[model samples]
Target: MMAATNNKEPQRIHPHKFTLWVAMGSIIMMFAGLTSAYIVKRSQSNWLEFSLPFVFWYSTATIIISSITVQLSLKAFIAREMKQYRTLIGITAFLGVLFISLQLVGFYNLESRGIPLFGVKSNSATSFLGIITGLHIVHVLAGVIAILVLFIKAYFSKIKNYSSVPLEIISTYWHFVDILWIYLFIFFNWPR
Candidate 1:
């Protein structure tokens, strides 16, 4: 008779990964509600329509490029190309900052046109734009912080086993934010 076999199925997701997924789901739901409200409010008589600033287009491109760099960084990490990984991560972080700066320029452009984010004269359209884009910026800031942490850890060789978990998580989050921004940009620009 053979001894009992100790077979185990692979764990597909880590606990931290599960937690991140749950958080992402909540965020999706929140944005869905916000966008739904935005659509419903658009038919109101006082809704203001304004063209988005040109800088927003530049920021959109910046975020898309950052997404590519983050993916490259992940691939480099998996291949154990530490130097390339570090450089890609650094570039991604810089792009994150650039995206934020461009977004600020967009906000300034709106304000210059007298579309303030909040005030008696501020219509729902401008307010929604501010709230939605501001929330996205906060998420991007969190992603940038995570990238910086990973970059620092990689720089100091703190990632002892060359584990891909942290990099994978960061990449997933970065991609999510990138896609979310793209969706928002399209949603805002779409004809009502």
Candidate 2:
């Protein structure tokens, strides 16, 4: 006897992907709360306004370029161009390091301008800048680590398939951090 088959789609999500999404949502909520606090604190009488460091602009550009490189890497992987994929992943990791270095330069620039994070002269603006950017740096570091792992796997001929879910998940997280930085940059630099 032949068995009848039901063609309904599965209602369950992959646990890993679902966990990542939940983590991302939590991150979004945390940032939203921090930014909201920033906005509320900006209305106080002791708020100090300052120009963002020029290096931040450069870092912003670097991150944007890195985002492009990551997307290119994904494309190359999909095309089974392992060499190109590895190269692009390396470039993305390099750009991530550059972004972190530029952020440090920005902090130094702020300090040189007498806007230290915890000195008597330090104000809410500088504190917010430091906190927000520092948190973002942590996220970028995580992304760089992910990219390095992918690069090492590719180098060792471990990544045989182009349809890797881990690669897609990492790409999504990278892009999220990229966009988050862009938003924070605009928010910090917006004219009062």
Highest lDDT: give the candidate number: 1
Q: Model 1: per-residue lDDT, tens digit, 109-182? A: 99998889878878889999999999999999999999998888877864387789888998999999999999
Q: Candidate 2 lDDT, tens digit per residue, 72-172?
A: 99898888887898899999999999999999999999998888976677888789888988999999999999889888888886547556677778888
Q: Which residue runs of candidate 1 sit more than 4 Å off their true CA positions?
A: 1-10, 157-159
The RMSD of every model to the true structure, in order and in angstroms, is 2.3, 2.8
Report every candidate's CA lDDT: 0.92, 0.89
Runs of candidate 2 with Cα error greater than 4 angstroms are 1-8, 11-13, 157-163
